[model samples]
Target: MLRAIVKQGLRASSRLAVNRNPDTSSYVQQLEAEWETAKPFSELPGPTRWQIFRGFQKGGQYHQLGMDEVMRLYRKQFGDICLIPGLFGMPSTIFTFNEATFQRIYRTEGQWPVREGAEPVLHYRKNRKDEFFKDCVGLFSNGPQWGKLRSAVNPVLMQHRNVAIYLKPMQRVNRQFINRIRELRDKDSAEVPADFLSTVNHLTFESVATVALDEELGLLREVNQPPGARKLFKNIEVFMDSFFILGMKPSIYKYFPTPTYKRFSQASDEIFDTCSMYVNKAIERIERKTAQGSTKDEKSVLEQLLQIDRKFAIVLAMDMLMGGVDTTSTAIVGLLLSLAKNPEKQQILRKEILGKLPSTDRDFSLEDMKSLPYLRAFIKESMRVYPVIIGNVRSAGTDVVLYGYRVPKGTHLLMVNSFLLKDEHLFPRAEEFLPERWLRQKDGNEDSANVLINNSLNPFVYLPFGFGPRMCVGKRIVDLELELTVANLVRNFHIEYDYPTETTFKTTFLYKPNFPLKFKFTDVKY
Candidate 1:
């Protein structure tokens, strides 16, 4: 219904007063205007105001007035890294958009608190907030609680170890991807769809499901988009929009989260519902153990989650749906497009792969991946060029100084990674995707080829997985999934961009290919 309204430009009165202010971008205008005469948020009884704000929260918009607004606000307010002596009573200081700042903000959490990230997150959590905040869920909680949960689960996800466990599933998904593309392209290998975004989504859907839920979608085998997968992608978009509006115009939609609000509210429920289904499946498996009085050793991550708390399981699952799905898919789309635009480099990398072990018949092991330095370099370059998450903001846990500005506590800090990736000073010929730049030369010779994100470079500058103790916990899972899937795809077939344009940028919120990409595969022969 809301989609119909949006498509048709249908009209209706806002259920709650929209913000009427002018300075707030149109995104926040309605809420800003609404705040003009609305009751002070603190004065609202119970959770009415909190609910309204949650219904319409839009944090991304606040970040995306471009970095200029973020910079100006940090400078104008308490200068940088200052206290949030406001009504919310939370400790926060906005940091300058730099690398050192990221290190200070994230590393200093022990002295301060990771709970600074919790309020907005917890407040927005609808059904599973309690469980998400409980003692054992590592990703969503803080302090001793986060420590315990992380300790239990971090082993499975500890950088390299987790990659070994799920390598086969990723390889399988990629082969499935190759098969699906062949089907989609009739006799003419040229018949492949111009856009690979949907294809990557289908691939990531299957990949993450295998690792996270021990389920498979075979979305590629179906040779059509998955219905829920399709909706799940859109739900992510809609929810981001809902959150952006809330940040832009907190007052406007706070009281009247209508129409758009309701659609997302429904989507939010659906997200939780989807998560619950997975959680329940894990729970049932755990319950079988409980029924027979078996020990926790007969458990997977999902089973362990069931033992700790189901609500947290549901939230983690939802986070995967929201976080895991789009990022991996969008990344691969950007990656293929990058190679398509740079055909010479693409061929070189393809030759490099074919020259190596050149077999996926056995389980594609991490060591196999380790052999493909160029493949690793190409993936790193793609991540640098088209990072799915440009940067996520951090509210300082306490007052800190950054870039000559006093960032007061509670001030919202926007970490601009897009700024760093594109900065010519840090990366000479920055726009050009040169994997060789990542390689370090020993003496004057092209000696040891290495792939590291330039250690001499500032830490806060580039954050694809985000920065701080509160950084993305599943970073390894995402890296492994992308590496295995993309390597397999490239190893099996050469990709050409059906369409290429430098100006193409799909969405403002997250980095995506500007348009649909079609690919032609030059079937590799060993």
Candidate 2:
């Protein structure tokens, strides 16, 4: 019956065409037939293909605005969840901000759940099998490969005790960064340089590399920094920027040698080469210690990972270095920007830091960080307002019901936390940054701010680090970096933006500030 209808549609379409190919006529007929049958997806309101196509023609506004525009337009018209048409008249992608539905899907996500990044890696491995990705699979792979990688690394990277091994190294990098900030500030204006993002990137790269590879790249040092470190930083940035473009857009890069694909390939080589160099060094060091019978009780992340699989260790380190640097720095930028905008909150945090870290030279132990509740609250509040990653995506592993609609398996699900965070019912005065909202009472009473907020806010809505098994593995490291740096900065100086810096949404595989952040730094009086 369906074939008969398709044949009739093809006949009708063929009649109107001046000179259409068989393939084109057949595709049009199929699309028309599918359009008639797929009423459930169409019932969910979204912009028409013409509307999206018109925006695409108007100087690439569709690509520039990207998912943010989709979430905004559909959520306004269709409430929490709606269908969003894809580029080039592709099937509609599901846009959801419903927390209950998200929880249901995530909790039931199977062992081989599909994720957002599998396609790009699969393409890379297929094309560069001999050159770049010969030995290992990427972290974002699905099915058995993803399960294997996750299980091997989780025991070492995700544990609290194993992660705490990097505290002293992070402290050293933090101190170097603070000192670098002191040098970068002007004497008269008392403001740091406008190119603060570069500094933050350098710091985060140094810290993550130290922990992930067990090598001192000395990226924070003003003099005699490793040449490979500088190259690695630039390459990682290029890799991230190009990955987003190639992954999101309908480009000829996949089939032809486009400029973006060329850049991505080159950056991938540089990143892999740099990580291999460091991994080999780390392995040699461990071999020497073992041969000499030098028994150290606790091993670094690289060592623990090497015990599982050497190639796995190298590839995971590359992922950590390549993927972690920009994101961790972006979070720091968000935290500092949030505090800089609100001086009173900055002072409150400064008092907490000063009380805990009395001397500038003293390092913040894991215990010390755990004691500072206000500092933790401040970081959480900053992330809540300006998330480093805008939202989460899951390709449904099975046919699931979301928001009363039976969404089919393999449909793309984009949960827009940016929309969820701004809902006034979930968060009172949602636009304002109130760190106290995340605070808890110390009087052993039930009326704590955190308790109240927890009661009111749905558990699924506040996933800054994501949720369940697929949550970020480097979350603990990011936490240590933020707390230590914020503590040390507050201990030494009072943070305030010299001018009103406008926050614009920019994308480089993740959301980051598009403008310069010039912060005024006044020395604190004890």
The runs of at least 3 residues in candidate 2 whose Cα sits more than 4 Å from the true structure, single-residue gaps closed, are 1-39, 47-54, 60-63, 77-79, 85-92, 131-135, 442-454
What tens digits encode model 1's per-residue C-alpha lDDT throughout 1-526? 2133222221211111122212236633543444454544233122233542343346632333433344344446534333222223333333344666666555433322354333333444533444533333435555445544444444445546556656666677777887787777647655476555666776777777766665665567764665765566567667655644444333333345556666656677676666667667766766687799984543455554454455655666666666677777778877877777788878778787767656756546677677877787788777777777546666555454444344444456555456578776676667888876656655654322322334367756656776444456678878777776666666777777654475555444465565656567666666
lDDT of 2 by residue, 1-526 (tens): 3233334534443342223223355644653454444546547766676666676565744646745664565677778878766653234578787888787567545554567744554566668847545535757776555655665566677888876788888888888998888888899888887788888999998888988789778777889988998898889889888887776655566567689878988888878788889899989999999999994788888888778667777788878887788888888888888878888888888888878778887788877888998899889888888778767777876566666666777888777776677777787767878877777666765434644464557788888887755788788888888888888888888888866565455753377767776887788886
lDDT of 1: 0.58
Worst 10 residues of 2 by lDDT: 14-23
Clashes of 2: 0
| Residue 360 error, candidate 1, Å | 4.6
Write down the lDDT of every candidate, Cα atoms only.
0.58, 0.74
Give the Cα error of residue 206 in candidate 2, in Å. Answer: 1.1
